[model samples]
Target: MTTRARPAIAAMAYHQGAFVPFAEAGLPLTTQALQYGTGVFEGIRAHTCADGGKLVLFRVRDHYERFLRSCRLLRIETGHTVDELVEITCELLRRNGTTADTYLRPLGYKLALLPGTRPGVGLSGVSDALSITGFPMGAYTPPGGIRCTVSSWVRPRSAAIPIHAKVTGGYVNNALAADEARAAGYDDAILLDDRGRVCEASTANVFAARSGRLLTPPATADLLPGITRDTVLALAADLGIETAEHELDVSDLRCADEVFLTGTGIGITPVNEVSGHPIGAGEPGPIARSLAHHYARTIRGGGDVRHHHWLTSVRIDQG
Candidate 1:
């Protein structure tokens, strides 16, 4: 007997207040979020659990907390509590029937239809909106390791903009640096702050290891306080590794024993070379490999009881 193939799950999204076909989702061209980049967003990952046919969202509560902080910074009144948003995201994933590694994006934005209003200059009559979308995603960095260069562009000062907030407008600065890096024949870029101190990579936070201890830029370095960065720190402590948060210099990376980038999208990716200098044996270092392995296991719900709280399972049966 022959069996018929099941139909694919239709791409779906949660916008405003309801689910809609992905292709049918739309917003006004004059939206303040669109015209002036007045929005904040987060990138979250979900992994298939080892013991069941369920997807586990990594650090959902932490992501939502950060999202709300971004909204408060941007004055976008999403009005939904963290629990409500988590429920919406879980329902969206259930509808999509995603079973592989997936990326979920939740955005809170100014929804006003002001054509030419600049960001932070408009009157108090605008509206706010939120949307959640998910899709299959894979490794954002190349296998093995990546090459990086120090970009000519500098990160925006915290005084000029709340650099910790994931505001859409702020990413233009990241884009410029990334583009410059790619054009100059590098896989990624490392940005510096106004004072020439190391800030972070184009899209992720930076970490360097020397003599077995881990070092990352301080919160005052004008970069996103990445959730993944926090996860790495926690995992490192559990593994009996020491960590330090302080100002870093470009020369520090050039002389470091190892380097890696961490974020929701990239996870923990090693840097083999920086600005033409080879890092520790010119490969993924031992410390990075250990942390990456632990991180992978924790995210996939693989016998790590300590991190069980980090996963939010999305199974139709549970609902």
Candidate 2:
């Protein structure tokens, strides 16, 4: 049967061994990642860097490092090392000639399938396959700001699953909450922890500023300790904004003067609503704006000298 055509956006994908049109980037129905979410992946971002007058990948190494850790934990073999993954990502972007905001995804998936069959429903460790894909992406909230709801779904406790590994299956839980929000006439969703505490956005880590202190969920809250999350914590310190990470409940979120979300795919998005109540003036706040501006400039190789550790320039071969 002829495959349905992919729109221009997803038609071409960087697939197994090389770039291929979407119709050709096919795998057998028994693929492990397809069956059970036996896969690990990372969401990476490339920003327009002032230093090189080009889009610079932000903390690509860190993301790859985490990727390696995830593969190790998930018992899947990622054919390439973290460094190799970084090289492949940069090359893919180079080929795409993307200069504006772009997103990178490198996934390591189980390959050796068990004889029993069902796509999207298996959970045994087998062999692995690694694939990388890239696309030009725009802003998450477009800086204008967006509203989000506190999801009825709560993040599973650590006893339930590993939140740090970024397993593809973990996001099925995320997608569920996100889909619920859209169905309810909202753009995004926020999840609480199993203990009924604020956790994170459906797809991004959440943060807020109140009493002049920058506050976020402690790593225990089931939120991914995001790379951008780390950046903001340190960025807040540099800006002399007191930063704190602790268990935050819904009341704290509702009463906070300002709220925001952060992730690789969506730098920093203001949270205008929580549990249907409008967040602080219902607009992006001063601290969110400051951090966003500083983050935009910092990722582009500006002001901070010590943070150079976060950036990697695209070094191409002379072939």
Candidate 3:
């Protein structure tokens, strides 16, 4: 896929109940979510179609479904249904007139304590707010591949937090893990569960290809069930590639033919090295390359008709 230059952030955003200038979309200092990290969010992408005629959002409904699920976990009410959120996202894209690859972040969070409510970090007494902002972004991962470190931070299990949900507060674990990896000169981090098994990467799902079959941890392994990871599994089935969901250890990845990470932001990126050792040939492997090619096309209305259903088209508002 051809990469585009990172464009300036859009000047508009969906704030509260209406679209507004980006500068006007700020939350107050007393916002409960800001103080307590009581928020949920989804990172969605919009791509210019192969013909460059218009922009299409990949799995927009699925993202919102997951977004709502996270909000429900946090007791945050978005006041918008899945379909309504989809339309609002399309309208936001149209208003921005974005013509390149873009990333959208929809955030639902606790606003403040409701009137007559006592001051506390309790979710029951807080008001809720939702906002979405978008900006241009291309493939953020290195095209060649990336090196990762087995992080010292252990991933929190569902017992400690809702590991399946994209809770804003839970990301502190991811941030610290990623920072440790970067400080060690690695591109990312692979986190292990309390049981000392591979759970996922800092912010993405981890996969290892062995004997032409793909293996990844089950959702019970204390990782967010990623939409992109689901897409890859479906696409692999279409390609007649076998897959299994099971626990994997560091030794498993070290011995596998290839290791890769999948997510909405980074797409599919190969892990060339881990903890100072090369994974396989220490480069992007054939399976990852093939899947990445197909993923790029599938997001842009390519492949089968069924795949096109995952895309939501929006015409640019040139006026």
Candidate 4:
């Protein structure tokens, strides 16, 4: 049984508008976000290139843009512009002095309630706070492929919760689905919508290769439209591979020639089986391999020149 890999976080963290020792970064027991799960966060990755020892942040601005949007949904004010957030991330990386593949988590959340305001369950009249933390992490999923199960927990509709944003409270649904899959001896969970349409995996977007084309659920399928998912679409277009966004169900996953997932954490991971049924030949297929290779190079500061704009370079100096 393959277990989830854990990352070693750096000693320092940016907390509450100041950089501090990770041990010193803490919230009060009565903090609203801690109590109510009224927080938003983004998962960002920075890759270290072998050629020049440069650490490049992938789609940092885009991540923060989505971060701010998620914050807005919860009325959590980050008080930082996209450019400012990017700069803070770069500065934090420099301070941490980590020269490896790193994962960043920027959290914006509700803090304590206002003095005159009474809170029972609300979004208004709460203080807001922001914290950014980094972890030294690399690709952890099996490149060969992984087994998955169709989760029994259906994804909550957007009407009930905004599925597009990475709101902290909204992840309980994903956690339940993932736990159910892992407990059943599967690597991850593929959740379906209330209408039985394939929503997405626990933490990543779904993609299936069929007839030499890539098919994924549309943004309307109550799934988080990941930045990595968008990147794959553009890269596929560059490679002349056809792509489509539509609804998919359990049968579609079982019938596809290849199944894979894309996200900051998983990157491009092939899915070999779904609920004990083999996907295609039950192995990682060629198209997935090709895109994974291309994605690796693209993030590490290689690949086509046009795609370089997606990376924000940070130079690391030896001490």
| Number of the top-ranking candidate, with lDDT as the measure | 4
Ranked by lDDT, top first:
4, 3, 1, 2
Over 235-311, each residue of candidate 2 has an lDDT whose tens digit, in order, gives 99999999888888888888899999998877888887776898889888999999999988888888588998788
Give the CA lDDT, 0 to 100, for residue 153 in model 3: 99
lDDT of 3: 0.91
- Model 1 residue pairs with clashes: none
Candidate 3 per-residue lDDT over residues 1-319, each given as its tens digit: 2233565779899999999989888889999988999999999999988767799899999999999999999999999999999999999998888778889999999998888899977899889999999998888888899999999999997899899999999999999999898888888999998779999999999999988989999977799989999999988888888999989999999998999999999999999999988999999999899889899899988766778889998888666
> TM-score: which candidate is best?
4
Structural RMSD, model 1 = 5.5
Error of 2 at 44 (Å): 0.6
RMSD (CA, Å), each prediction: 5.5, 4.7, 2.2, 0.9
Kindly list the per-residue Cα lDDT of model 1 for residues 1-319, writing each as its tens digit.
1122343333998889899998887898867788888899999888888776899999999999999999988888887999999999999888887677788999988887445554564524578888888878767676588999998999989999789999999999999998888888888899998889999999999999999989999976799979999999999999999999978898999888999999998899999999999998999999999999999888889846988999999884434
lDDT of 4 by residue, 82-130 (tens): 9999999998898888788999999999899898888678899889999
TM-score of each: 0.93, 0.89, 0.97, 0.98
Q: Which stretches of candidate 3 lie over 4 Å from their true place?
A: 1-7
- Give the local distance difference test score of model 2: 0.79
Off by over 4 Å in 2: 1-14, 19-23, 51-53, 114-125, 315-319
How does candidate 3 fare on TM-score? 0.97
Candidate 4 runs further than 4 Å off: none
Off by more than 4 A, model 1: 1-10, 113-120, 316-319
